[model samples]
Target: MTDKRIIKSSKVLVTGGAGFIGSNLVDRLLEQGNQVVCLDNFATGKRENLDLALQNKNFTLVEGDIRNYEDCVRAVKGCDYVLHQAALGSVPRSIKDPITSTDVNIGGFVKMLFAAKEEGVKRFVYAASSSTYGDSTNMPKVEDIIGNPLSPYAITKYANEVYAQNFTDTYGIETIGLRYFNVFGRRQDPNGAYAAVIPKFVMQLMAHESPIINGDGTFSRDFTYIENVIQANQLAAIVSYDNIKELQVGSKSVFNVAYGERTDLNQLFNILKKNLSEFDYKISDVNVIYGENRAGDIPHSLANIDKGKNILGYNPEYCIQRGLEEACKWYWENL
Candidate 1:
């Protein structure tokens, strides 16, 4: 395994800085004494997410859309590294409006990459998705073995991996892609139609309402915590290309950023209910409604995170139970 190196004394640009993952990353970066510039249009990102960040003198919020070339250019100026987290994330949302998703995800990705290249940023790190593992039924997903994409969102993420590689090969710009699994934690919006299952369930239970499961509650996922994702990003930004090249497949590489375990929906519900019940006893009695299985969703997901551990020194600190405990506490206090 590689030794961990924290990113400090540098300037970093986080594209979706006001979003859940981006804002969290921004906070950690700032804590490490790095100058952080956040580029977000507040489309899905919340202004409150960056409240603590706005207080820091080292943090700058650039209100901009990634789709516009000028906005991307303006964000990348004087940055040493680019953390590309700006993208429309939901599979259903992309299916409904593929054009807008494509324009923002694919089109905007290229613009940011171009801007990073022009600015001579040391490295470009992006958020890839586990949805890219579309039809593959592998027990543990490895970096190189991916099947056909199942949704428009998945296609866009896979295209990002391809584009990052192309940019690295053709322009010599360094890039790393962190394929995030079912990430959940604080600040995750639970009210949206495309809300993630964990936070959505948390909200329902808090309201003494039944949380709906899309399947028989047998389908499982490698639910990664936000803190683990922050560690992966910091490692990806600082790790040398030469050290990573020794382990990576090509000029650019992607690593699975997950907790390396799976938890079915039933177990997840029980855990959340149990955790939240500490604050509100009635939550323990909250029932769950099982619905039809979501189309395009796989039965199980488990990440073989050996690549990240060996190369980037990514050691995830939170498991499903631990993460849920933390998440439940945050929701109880904040919501």
Candidate 2:
């Protein structure tokens, strides 16, 4: 991270600000003395995520949908930077309802990008996904290397990168995309059909119930912590345009935002159980159940974070073990 955090004392707009990641970013921005506006419709976001932010004088909540251009324009009003975190996430959800996912992830993305351009924001940083790696057999995924998108959710994220680059080329808007790998942390929702594995497993184990693995437990991911993601967003918001153009592949910059390490599902399960068992003795005795692999699931995932470190001065502070310790502690105390 840079000594001079560039986004300080500025007006910033965080789309999907009521969600887990968005709300955390909002709180960080507000704490740094930035006037922050959060845009969310509560479709997947929880209002309680903004409880602390709402109490802060620097925070404003815009109850609106990104699918609506007018709502997008209103949210971008007078903001210097736009962190576009809004999207319909989850592979199974997209597989079941590709149309709605397309409307929200693709259509909503275009509206937010155009709104930033129209508002003349200094920069636009967005939440990209590791799912863009798709069916690639690459050991450590790089920014330029990719394979066919396995799910509609992956396609939408790739489309976001494409549109962001095009906007930079055609409209002269500065954009940066952070391809996040399996981000987990505080405030992540634990109850839902589309809940992420970490939080879902935490809740089940809290109740002394068995947590099920989606496969034979060989699948792996480069589980990144949320604080590292926040660091990447700040760096992307601040890095000079000249520096970005030098690394530009298609008029914009994209980097893999990860901890640069992989953990298998079996290892993840054991860690979670061990961490949560501190709260309840029975949790230590709980066992895991294995089922068929999920649709659109990848066998392994890892990232090469050299691009971010070399260009943006990004040094991730938390590894998987440290991150899981923090996340598990939060779930036990708060949820």
Best prediction by lDDT: 2
Please give the distance, in angstroms, between residue 100's alpha carbon in candidate 2 and its true position after superposition: 0.4
lDDT of 2 by residue, 188-222 (tens): 99999999999999999998889899888999999
Where model 1 places Cα greater than 4 Å from the true spot, the runs are 1-4, 248-252
List the global CA lDDT of all models. Answer: 0.92, 0.93
What does the lDDT come to for candidate 1?
A: 0.92
Q: Put down candidate 1 lDDT per residue, 1-335, tens digits, no spaces.
A: 13347788999999999999999999989988999999999999999999999999999999999999999999999999999999999988998888999999999999999999999999999999999999897779988878888888999999999999999889999999999999999999998889999999999999999999997999999999998999999899888899866664652389999999999999999999999999999898899999998866778899999989988889999998989999999999999
| TM-scores of all predicted structures | 0.97, 0.98
